[model samples]
Target: MHHSGERGERPAIREKSRGIWRTVTWRELAEEAAALAAAASARGLQRGAHVALLGDNRPRLYAAMCAAQWLGAIVVPLYQDATADEIASSIESAKVTHVFAENQEQVDKLLEILPRCPTVRCIVYDKDRGMRHYKQPELVSYASLLQQGRQLAAEKRDFLQAEAARGTGQDSAFVFFTSGTTGPAKGVVLTHASLIDRARVAAATESLKDTDVAMAYLPPGWIGQNLFSYVQPMVVGYCVCCPESSETMLADMREMGPTYFLATPRVLEALLTQVTMRMEDTGGFNQRLYRAGMAAAHRIDAGKTVSLSDRITAAACSLLIYGPLRDVLGMSNVRVAFTAGDAAAPALVTFFRALGINLKQLYGSTETGFFVAMQRDGQVKPDTVGPVADGVELKFTEQREILVRSPGMFKEYHRDPETTAQARNADGWFHTGDAGYLGDDGHLRIIDRIKYVGALNDGTAHSPKLLENKLKFIPYIKEAVAFGDGRDMVCALIDIDMAAVGRWADKRSISYTGHADLASQDEVYELIAEGIAKVNADLAQEPALAKSQIHRFVILHGELSPDDGVLTRTGKLRRGVIAERYRALVDAMYGGAKEVRIDVEAGHADIKVRDAEIIGHRQIRSAA
Candidate 1:
């Protein structure tokens, strides 16, 4: 709000609505937030009351967040894609007194869960096209809410300002829900001081400027997006662009030309897959030129050291191919890009860095307000999340579980004192639940979840996440689950990326109906085998991990989904659930069966039967 008075017309948030770009200037944003704060006060929302915001990337959601904070209320961002059951649990747990829904779809979800959350007194909705017929007492149009605020503001001009003045740094800022891969999601409580302090530190570390632009497309519920799109943007006074929809994010990014970019490993993989598929389609002179240029560029190390001849070739390639390719991927103007939340494949990381993009990695969680370790300029390492952030201290347990003591560390788990106590020690160190160690260079290399790190009977260690990331680097592979704990050799169940593989199949003139039919093809099996072989070749370089090579594998009948109880909403595998659900398939691979019949249900009623074809040797030399 202070920045708005000094810089009245600067754009703070931009978004596409009905195919046209619309911007919210800083002054206008402040007015909207203040008005909304007045509305909350009129609706009897008190200090410390939780306000749940559910929506896709939109300006109103961000404004609602600021408005809640202005009234000294804690904001809880719920995933727009969350199921009704998930919504109900979050609302009940947080005891949300107010909600901001973006559209009728979101309002419907709120309606479904309202019976379980009786504390919800006000439900304000934007984009009310289909909501005119609704007769719910608690439902209020977003425009109406603003009007109510206007009336309240007229009655007492300083109402919002007074509320804001009453808030303190120690007050709760927001509540973030963990991905809950192992169990039910936990609400992590963070304070205003922790978030603002860390946001400033991150901005300084990156040398962020008000001129820098960012794209907001990830789930608002995730801490990664919350930090990048919400906290940092506010602290640095940068513009955050919201895409029209999930399907148009890349196009929007390209048009907006964001200077700072952050994507999850899955998003990066998808983008890389698109580039690879496009390159494959280019033929003759262009294809040869691209291949030659990329080969020359690959020779240049990530640090940008290059021979004279290599530099010349690289510059020529950037002009002819690399520059346009980066533009198409929405990374041409990206000054500092990062991939985080999960292990990114080394191949994917190096692929962009080799092309002169400053793609780096960071490691943090909701508990740390999202700033723990970050890669600084000119110190990129694909194998590790770089050095600890300024003002953060990092250590490890005797078992190698990462522990952190930082100013940005969250206060507690909301209403879950027992879990909160378990997350930290008496000395105030927060247990990260991640297995990792500091490298000789001071970079932190994460192996896997502490409890998920396993070993073979012969004592060779295995990190399923590491291996799975390697597999995902292959454009055709989407997700992988490695199993070998206490067993003789590692094995895997793989899900092929249908979009990329489908394009490949079309290029080859192969006729296939759907994912299941295409996956069962022998040719698709060969493609998966090729990916596994590449992973094994990489593993051969490390003696300790060589034994962890996948000796046997099976192609899954379908993609693992959150609704299926196979994957969490954030894409982390529910390994125990997956292993038990597919026990028959797992047994067949270990029992020396060539192929096993499997039954998968599509949605609630459609029964689909397919065969899990095992295709590897026990000795691990070659596929059988």
Candidate 2:
């Protein structure tokens, strides 16, 4: 395969850092990567050696990844937000002998755990923040390392070429850790061929173009980032832009004007909230105009040809309303956007489509190198995850679990035969653990995880994810977790969108103390009851999940936190863990109790009361 810089002076990466947009051409990237690889080799990093990379979105981090691949060394990326203990565990498990940290804070964490991780020999740090006092003899600055590599390459040019020749399609390119659904993270070994095949398939299926630009804001440690940043770029020759920081993503996005965007449902939800909040701030005249334009856009979104008069109105609105909106959101140039980590609200999908963005859903996992299925342009559907990508064969097991066989599938979980065997059957189909079915139109509709799925005492199957997604579609509800599995009726734990709830409270002059107190207020419950009733009405229209109605619900006193073991680092809920932690609340829901008191483990002892009031409502459908 050709390297990134082989295409002359074309820009390969645009990184905004320290108030400057630094543009690096393919040739420059290739040179820097080569230098870094030589420098690493000089530091005794052999081919097959494991190197841990810890950083946020940065150009040097990307260069280090490419350099590791050039030398046939496996790159193990750790979450930048990881604590010292988590980093140490991953390092020890991967047997990482070398590390590249973005800043001194990470280097300090590595130093703190050095005594336990004997395998780590050398440390190279990028940002020079607060590292002068660090007295480690083995530590070196990234600039110094790159300089050493450049000098070494000048001295032994032929040797560097021979070292670069060591890499091949068969070599293990990356070792991605899973989301750690069970215990600690398990490494999934992916070779160059596996990643490239997946990228090729995704590019062909999506019809990705070389001119397409994708924002690389997701964590590189995740498989999604690797696919979008490393693999897809190699296959489609697209430019990947690194935002200055997480805080400046919206601003950077506006500047980059990316054609292809990928984000989680949480991110999309936040954007929708921002849009709604801004609309609330607008004057009545602007609000009416916005609403009218959106109504027209919705008609266009529904595959209906616009009338000539409506087209003229929409064109005028595009200039007056939508153009500025898209510019402000930095999505004016977006040709295709995707959301996939968790289930997204169909309204959120339709909202973007109504704004003239071709936003769609994708379904995949780390085991498949993040390439499974994508909703093609002009065929986007809100209810389904679209069709399988080219070269991927999907089937349903007897239990209705999705099974996939593709070239992108990982070889095996590192050092764990038992776990690997549990995922893949003897017939070579990888069990996705997801319950889904193929529709009459050949689209795949994922209900929920097979393990999380439960049956009612009356023998009806219940899908909590389906119910939760439906509830989250309500504007006031931020998150909802439905619990029924093995129970007679379904109950829900709801988290309110504070901004939206605050707006409602302000209009009604409902005073509250804080989030916890506001959530427990009787008025808040009434507000949420109305939202829940709307979700129930929507669910009642569906056939399968309609039976599992949300019989009861209570607003959670506080948002779920990682420390509480309720949410993962990526913000995915650990359903079993959350249910176990909130057993008292769940019990109260089914016990027909009006209220329950639970001890919250904050810094000090805090007693909180959670109350649930049932709102009797029946099926009330609204025009779609």
Q: Number of backbone collisions per candidate, in order?
A: 0, 1
Model 2 lowest lDDT segment of ten? 604-613
Query: Stretches of candidate 2 above 4 Å error?
Result: 1-5, 292-296, 304-317, 503-513, 602-624
Q: Which is the leading candidate under lDDT? A: 1
- Residues 1-624, candidate 2: write the lDDT tens digits: 264535647667889988688987777888888899888888888888899999887778888888887788899988787788888888888899889999988898999999999999999999898888887977999999999988887875777678777668878888888766545678988899989998888787777987889998887788888788778987888888998998899999999999988988888877777777777778697777778777777777777888876676667777887788788889999988889877776778888777777899999888887778888887888888898887889999788899999888888887788989998988779998888999998888888888887888887788888778778766678878888888888889998888788887888899987888788778888777877766766666666656677888878888876656677666677887888988888888888887777877554222223333333334242243
lDDT of 2: 0.81
What are the lDDT scores of the predictions, listed in order?
Answer: 0.85, 0.81
Off by over 4 Å in 1: 303-306, 602-624
Give model 1's TM-score versus the native structure: 0.95
Q: Estimate the TM-score of every prediction.
A: 0.95, 0.93
Q: Per-residue lDDT for 1-624 in model 1, tens only?
A: 876986669999999987899999999999888888888788888899999999987999999999999988999999898988898999999999999999999999889888888999889999989998999999999999988887777765677668878989999999998889777899999999999999999899999998999999998989888888888978888899999998887788889999999988888888888888888888877777777777677666554566787778778878877888888887889999998878787778888876668899988888987889998887887888899999999888899999999999899999989988999878889998899999999998888998889888999887788888888888898888888888887888888899988888998999998988888888888888887887887676566677777777887767888878787777778888999998887888787777776665653212122233223344345532
Global fold similarity of model 2 (TM-score): 0.93
